[model samples]
Target chain A: MLLDKFQSMAGVRAELEAIGIVPFGAVTEKITSATEGVVNGHQVILAGTNNYLGMSFDTRCIASAQAAAETWGTGTTGSRMANGTFAEHIALEQELAQFYGVDQAIVFTTGYAATQGMCATLAGPGDVILLDADSHASIYAGAQLSGAEIIRFKHSDTNDLEKRLRRLGDRTGNTLIVVEGIYSMLGDVAPLKEIAELKRRYGGYLLVDEAHSMGVLGEHGRGAAEAAGVEDDVDFIAGTFSKSLGATGGFCVSRHALLEAIRFSVRSYIFTASATPGVIASVRTALKIITAEPQRRERLWENAQLLYTGLKQLGLAVGPSVSPVVAVTIEDRVEALQSWQKLLEAGVYVNLVVPPASPSEKSMLRCSVSAAHSPEQIDHIIAAFAAVNAARPVGIPVA
Target chain B: MPNYNIYVDYIYTVLRTIKQDVEFTENTDLVTELGLSSLQVMELIEHIEDHFDISISLNILPDINTVGDLARKLQELNG
Candidate 1:
C-alpha cells in the first residue's frame, strides 16, 4: 500500500519511453573531459551540466582533492558537530565568510540541507514564510518542516509580494521572505533591489538562495544580491558548491553574528555526515580560483550569450534572459520529450524537465553554459539545435 | 454586508491574469475550463485570503470546484 501511490508512475514512464524520452535519471556513460562527455556510447557535448566556472577539471582543484583524500580518509564517518568537523571545514567556512563579507558561515552536506536546516532552525510555528510561487523544491521542503505559516506570491512579482506583506499586518515583522537569486529551472534572476526595498518597508528577514547565481553574478561574484547592490539588505544567503564551485556542498552565510548558533540547533547539520575531505579541498581551491580568475565569469557570460542568441535565432523559445543557464521552454510534454531525444541523438545533451517540477507546469530542455566551452563547441550546440528544429519543429500541435 | 459583485470581480481578475480574453461565469470550472494547475489555484486562494482578511483552511479545498463554489465558500467563511 505504501508503494501504491507511485504505481501510476510506471504508466507515465512507459509513455515517455514509448516516445523515446528517458525520464528522471538518464546516465552519461563516461566523462572524457570537463565539457565533453560520452553519453549512451556516443561522444556528446555537455550543455546541461551546471559547471558554470568549469573548475572541476582545473589542475589545482583536482590535485588538492586527490591530496586531501590521501591525507584524510575518503569519508567523514560522522556529522560536523560530532566527529566530522576538520580543520579544512573550519577554514573553508572562514574563507566563505570572508568571500561574502558575512559574519558567519555554516556548511552543510548538501545545498538542500542548508536551506532545509536554515528554514527549520530559524522560523517556528507562529512565524510566517512568504516565498515565490516558483521556488525550488528544497525551499518548499524546508518551509514544510519549519511549522510556519507558508505564503506564496506570484513569481518575480514584487508588487504581489508587497501586497501579501501589507496584509500580514502585525505578523510582517516576524515573517521570512524566501527567494532564489537565479531560479534553477527558468534561469531568471530575482528582482532583489525591489525585494530588499520591500523588506526595509515591511520589516522582515530576507533570504536569497543563490544556488545558481553565485560565481555568475556581481563584481566580486557574490551573487544576485551583490549584483543588485542589496547584499547588506539580504539577511541570509544559501548557496551550493555543486554549481560554479564544481564540487558538492552547501553553505549559509549571514551578517548576523548569531548565525553561528545554527550549527548547534540545526538537526540536518548536526545529524548528517560532513562533506568528504576531497570535496572540501576541491571547493576551497575552486573558491580561491573564482575570486582570482574573474575572466572565467566573463567567459561564462560570453558562452551564455552565444548559446542564447543562437537558440533565439534558430526560432527556439528560451527563458526570460541570458545567463549561465538557457532553458528552451516547450509547453507540451510529448514534444519536449521528442526534442530531447532528437538532440541527444545528434550528439548533444541537455536536461529534459517536465511538469510540477518545472515552473508554471511547462516542460523545458534546460542547458547550462560553461566558461570552458570552446567556440567550436558552442557553435556545434547551436547547429545541433538548428538541425533538430528543422527536422522536428517543436511547435507542432497535439493530435 | 459584503458586496458579491466585488468578490466575483476579484476572482475574475485573478483568472484573467492567468489567462486574458477569457470570461469567468459563476459555474465555470477553474481547473478544467480555465486550465489552472494546482499551484495556480493555491495562488488564487492566497490572493483571496489576503484581500478578504480571512484564512481558508485546507479542509474546505475539496469542496471548491467551480468559481461559484469558491465565491460562495468565501462568503460563508466571511459571515
Candidate 2:
C-alpha cells in the first residue's frame, strides 16, 4: 500500500516499453553544440532545451567557468547560511539585483527553490494568495506550504482575476497575486498590464516568475513585466539562470527592502548548498553577454517567427503566439507519442508533454528555439514535422 | 452560524453546474463519487468562496472529502 501510487506509473512505463520507445528519459550520447546533440544514437537538432540565449556553449562562458573552477575549486560544498557563501555567490546576487534594477536579490540553488522559497515565505496563514491556475509547480508547492487561503483564477483571464480580487475586498492588501511572465507550455504571456491595473485598483503585492521570459522579452530582456512597462508595479521578480543564462541557479529580486529580512526567513535558501563557482562564473559571463548583445534576442525572435510560420503553414496547431517556446498540440496521445519517436528518428529532438505536465488536456510536442539555431536548422526542424504529418494515417488529423 | 443544510443545498447547486446528471448529497464523496477533476474541484471551491465571500485555506483540502464535510467546514468558517 505504501507504494501503491507507483503501480500506475509502472503500468505506464511498461506500456511505453512495449511500444519500444523511452520518451521520458531519452539519453543524449553527446552535445555537439547548443543547437545539436546526439540523442539515442541519432544526431538531432536540440529544440526542446530551454537554452534561449545559447550561452551553454559560448566560448566566453566556458572560459569564465574554467577560470572560476581553477580559482575557487569545483563547488562550495555547503549551504550559503553555513560555509557555502563564497565571494562569487555574493557577487552573482549583487549582479542579478543590478540587472533587474532592484535593490536586493537572493540567489537559490535552483529556480524551483527560488520561486518556491519566495512563495512560501512572502505570505502565510491568515493571508490570501491569488495565483493563475496555470502557474508552475513551484508556485503551487510554495502556495500550499505557505498555508494561505489559495485562490486560483482562470489562466490569464483578467476578468476572472478581478472578480476574485473584488471578492477579497478589504483583505486585498493581505494578498500576494502571483503570475508568470510567459507561461512555459503554451508560450503565452501574462496580461501584466491589465493585472497591474487591477492591482492598482485593488491592493496586493505582485510577483512575476520570469523563468521563460527573462532573456526572451522586453527591450533590455528584463521579461514581460518590462515589455509591458509595468516593472514599477511588480513587487518581486523570480527568474532562473538555467534558461537564458545557460547555467543552473535561481534568484528572486525585488525593489522592496523587506527582501533582505525575508532572505533569512527562506528555508530553501538556507538549506540548499550554494551554486558552484563555475556555474556562478558562467552565469555572470552570460549576463554580461545578454546586456551587451541585443542581437541575440532579435535573432531568437526571428527564429521563433520562422518556426511559427512554418508550423502554421503546415496546418499544425501551434501556440497562441510566436514565442521562443512553440508547442504543437495533439489531442491524440498515441499519435503524439509516435510522432515524437518519428521526429527523433528524423534527427530532431523535442519535448513530449502530456496531461498534468501540460497546462491543458492535449498532448504537446514542445520545441524551444535558441538564438544559436541557424535559419537552416529551423527549416530542418519544420521539415521533420512536415514529414511526420505526411506519414500519418489518412483518417487521423495532422499534428 | 449558517445552517448546515443551506450549505449542502448551495453546494448541490454549484455541483450541478459542473455535472448536471450526478446526484449529490451530504454523504456523497466529492472526489470518488462525482469523479471531479482537480480543475473542477478548484472551480467548485472558487464558487463556494465567491458565494460565502470567505477565503478558504488549501491546507484544509485534504481533510475535506464529502459534501457534509465541506458544509461543516463552511459553517465553522462562517461562525
Best by DockQ: 2
Give the best candidate by lDDT: 2
Q: How many pairs of residues collide in each model? A: 0, 0
lDDT by residue (tens digit), candidate 1, A1-399:
788978779889887778666746878889877799887656899999899999888999999999999999899999998899999999999999999997799999999999888887788788988888888888888888888878778799998888888878889888999999999987899999999999999899999999999999999999999999999999999999999999999999999988988678998899899999999999999999999999999999999999999988877788879978898888788778887888888889899888778875678989999999998999999998888777863442221
Candidate 1 stretches with Cα past 4 Å from truth are A393-399, B1-36, B46-79
lDDT of 2 by residue, A221-319 (tens): 999999999999999999999999999999999999999999999989999889999999999999999999999999999999999999989899998
**How does each model score on TM-score?**
0.90, 0.94
Evaluate all candidate structures by whole-model CA lDDT and list the values in order. 0.88, 0.92
Q: For model 1, name the residue pairs that clash.
A: none
As a TM-score, model 1 comes out at 0.90
DockQ for model 1 equals 0.20
lDDT of 1 at A326: 91
Interface RMSD of 2: 2.8
